[model samples]
Structure formats: structure tokens, C-alpha cells
Target: MFLSMSFRLRTEVEALNMVEAMGAYSRHRTVSLLKPRGDGKGYRLVIAPAVSGQAIAFGYMKSLVELAQQKNLPICDQCRNYESKGGFVKHGTDTSGDLENLVRSCIVEDVTGFMIAKAEVRRTSAIQFSYMTPDIDSSDVAIDPQFHVRAAKPGEKPQPFQVESGTAIYVLGVALDIDKIGVVPDSNGKPKIVVANRAERVKTAIQAIAHLLEGLSFGAKKARYLPVYDVVGAVAAISHPVPFMVSPARISKDMDYVTKTVLRASNYVKLFSDAKETIKLFYMDKENVVGEVKAENIDITKADNVSELVLKIIEVIEKSLRD
Candidate 1:
């Protein structure tokens, strides 16, 4: 007679070996972690993705402690020496606020049915869903050859600078233009972040710079503004609604694209502005404009609201007496 016998693994034995066999067992585990599935004696715990090791250990300890307490088992000795033994003690142990740590017991079941057979362990804080859109546009941006403000070395067609919709552009080197809201120049010379929305302010600052560049190019030196305006026209001509729609994941990508485009545009404008400033400084012998050009004086106070941002660009120009 040939007889095959199976040995049922004890809960204590399994707990003892959990740390040792984790690597080997994790490979076969399907990771279908769910709510605790058993009672005091025997229960199944489902492991979920993104669940940290600490959390799992806590879950395991909690169920085990509950079972021990039900059986009237003594946990004091283990609880007392936990700090030295590298074990955890649950809260309400001594009420010293040092017991937030969890206590878990090792448990295993055999194929044979036992009391409270096929029980389950319970847990909380499962997967979460996000309502707002993600901010990265994965398709529109690439990792290679970082976008540059200046043209790529000769023979390269300027790479398409695509951006996601709802992406905002900002002005570079224009932080200095912010009006201090009735404050004279402070000793430190650094702009403060009181009521102004820093990020939106950056965008407004860039617009100010753009208007400043326009005024510099057209007013003092006529030809300097022409090249840059032509560049702007070229960009606008090819401009197409970002190749894709907006989503949370794609928003970030689109933001980067838009940022790069805005930066490049601002840089081009700066190049022309700087060239004119230099030409005026050296050949024309003219002083730098002081919030000078009527167009460059962006009323940050007036642009404090949404209606101002959307409709006031035209109002700004129409209101200007020089134009």
C-alpha cells in the first residue's frame, strides 16, 4: 500500500518563517490583496498594489492580536520586549503615545477544514480614484534633445514646439516689472509674494515684457521690431490647436510644451529688445525706457481679475494715447 500524507503548517510556524521566505513566496503570489477574509482562527488577507510593506505588516499584526485577545492569550511579555526584539506593540498598550506601531501574528491553514474555516481578515484605505484631470500630456512631449530658445545649429529645421491646451505661458526676466502696490523700493530689492498669485504673475510679467519688446522695436528703431514680428507671424501661421485634447496625464506634457514655446517666443522678443537697447545705447545714445513706453507699463493692479486677463489686452492698447 502506498500512502501519501500531508502536513498542515501551523500559524505560529508560518509567522516565524514569513520574513525568511518572503522573496520566494512573493514571486508566486498573484497580488490579489482584498479585504480581510477570515475570522479569529483562520483568515485570508488580500494584498493590493501600492500597499506598502509597513501597511501589510500592520494588517497582519492587527488580525493576529485580535485572535489572541479572543483566546485570552497573554501578549504582555511580547509587548514589553517588543522594542528590544524589533517587534511592534499596538496602541492602548500603555497609552504613552509610543504604541502607534502595529502587532501582527503569523497564521497559516491546512487544506483540511478546521473551526471557523475559510475565514477572512478586514482592512481599510483601499485604492482611490482621482476626479481632476492629470497634468501631463504624454504624446505631445519627448525626452530627447531638450527644447532650446535659440535655433538648432545650422541645417536643422526648428523642431515643432507643441503644447497642450489650457497650458499657460509665462514671461521670462520680467519679475522686476511687478508694481509693489504703493510701496517704495525696499532695502532688499526682492519682490514680495503678498496678494499676487506668483504663477499667474509670471504669466502677466511675460506679457508685459512682450508689450515692452513691441514698443522698443517699433518706436525707437523701426527695423528691429520687424524681424521679431515676422518671427511671431511665422509661428502663428503654423499654429494649430495642440495635436490632442486635454487630460490629467497629458496636462503636464502639454504644460511643458507650452512653457517651452512661450519661453522661446519670449527669448526671441528679448533678442530683438536687447539688440535695440544696445543699438540705442551705443549708436543712438538714448536712455532706457522707464516703465517708459506707454505700452510697457502693465497695470498689475488692473489685471488682478479674470475679466481683465481675457478682455483687457485690447483695452490696454485702445486706451494707450500713443497708439
Candidate 2:
């Protein structure tokens, strides 16, 4: 099973992710992209603040470690200590030279993947994250430097610094291959399940995703500048036998992205009509930001919040596992 999701986040006065501090100014990560001009003539370049995929992935891994520990799943010493700066685990020394031992012994390594530089053995991660960036179609995106100062003594000068803060409707996309957890490819390049409790591991993986989004757990600088954020809207797609990516919410502000993604998924499903390929969609529209969505052929589930939506998806996954 392959799961893809896209969500809209509204953050105000947030310095969630930042680059190196240059002098007294701390810079927020920004990217330049070409956007269609309102005149319908040409495209213009827009520089927008963004949160890196690395940052988001790190946060997700942290949540994964916590959930795995709660279930008494094995985690390497390095990952348990939250070492290597980004929740990276050390490669296990498998004396038998079989990489399967490495994955079977540690849930973190199995899900996030790792590379043995000396041996040149690498495992691709089952989960993927896209950079959290402002919606290109929205006109309310803005980033500016906020000035701050440290407390001064009776006769001492104040220490002042600048940090970039942003306000925008940001979009984030994530994908996970549920079948890959606790499974490794064999020497013949065929998938092999190395762990015995595959269902438990898969459910934990899904739960970690819920913990990450619902808790708003990703990003940095929460000690001082915690961004006021809300999940404005979201859409998720689940497919079997073939990978299907949902359309991102950043495409346009005028159209409902949820309906658009369902239509696209419906078309994709028809391509494999003779096969067992199937897709299911779920969406949540808070504050009526997405308005009404219109589609047919497939049923779309609606949830009142993020937790409820994830629970519905988990039910489908559990049923698939039983089959």
C-alpha cells in the first residue's frame, strides 16, 4: 500500500526554520520560484520562506522513535539517544554479512533507511517529505525580520538581534510505502519480510504520522517564536498495487484541491481497470477554506479533524493487512 497526503498550514509570525545567523541577523530558509503573473502574459519570480525536508524528516523520526519505544520495538543505541543530530541510527555490525539483520534488529533503521559508507550498502527510506513552503497561488505570503533585544543592566547596553518571521498559507506533501516497513530487498531484488510482527510495525508507522501532524511537531525555535498555526485543509490518497501521488494543495487558490485530486486518482484507477488496483480518498476542510468539492465514481470520506482522518485511513490499512 502507498499513501500520499497534502495539507495546508496557516502560520503567523513564525520563525520555525532558520538558516545560519549572519552577524546579528538570522535568516529563514527561502526559495525562488516562477509564478504565473496575474496579467496572464508571463511568469514572475517569487522568493518565499520555506522549511526544509530534512527538518521535517528529523521531526518525524523523533516521533517514530518515541512510538517504537512505547511498543517495546527495538531501536539502536544511537537512535534511542537521539544522536547523530538528525535521529540517524548507526549501522549495525552484522557478522554474517546479511543486511536483513540490520533491519530486523532496529525499527528506526528499517523505516528511515541508512547507508554504510564503507561497505557501500544502502537502504532507501520508505517515507518521503517535501519542503514546507508557501502556496504559490496565495497572495498573503510574506516574510520579514523581527527585531529583539536582550535585557540590559543598569549601565549596560542592550543586546539586539534580528530573526526572520513569516506568515503564509504553506503546503506540505508526504508519502509512505506501507509495504516496505520491516521488509528488505533480497539479493535477487525481491522484497522479503524480515520482521515477524509486520502489522504492529506498520500500525506504529501510521501512528507516528498522526503524532507529527496533529502535534505540529516539526520545525525549530519553539522556545521563543512558536508560530500560531492551524491546519486549514488537507487531502489524502491511498492506492494498492501501484503508487499514486495526490495533487499538491499549492496548485491554485480558486479551485478545491480535494476534488481535483480525487478526479486525478479516478483517472489513474481506470488505467488499471483490468487489475486489482484501487484507491480511496479522505479530506478535511476546516473553516470552510476549501468550499464545496464535486466529484463522482469513487466515494470520498470527510473527517472533522486530523486525528479522525488518520484513524479512518488506519482502518483501511488494517483491513488491507488482514486480506
Give the whole-model CA lDDT for all candidates, comma-separated: 0.23, 0.83
Task: Give candidate 1's error at residue 84 in angstroms.
Answer: 88
Which candidate's TM-score is highest? 2
lDDT of 2 by residue, 1-323 (tens): 99999988888888878898456789989988678898888999999988999988888888988898898998877788875544564553332334688788888788888877666677889999999988878646888999999798899999898999888888899999998998887789899999999888888888888888778678889898888988878899889888889888764645678868877888888888777678889998885756565556556799988888889999999888988
For candidate 1, what is the TM-score? Answer: 0.16
| Residue 229 in candidate 1, Cα distance off native in Å | 34
- Residue 273 miss distance in model 2 (angstroms): 1.7
Report how far residue 125 has shifted in candidate 2, in Å.
0.7
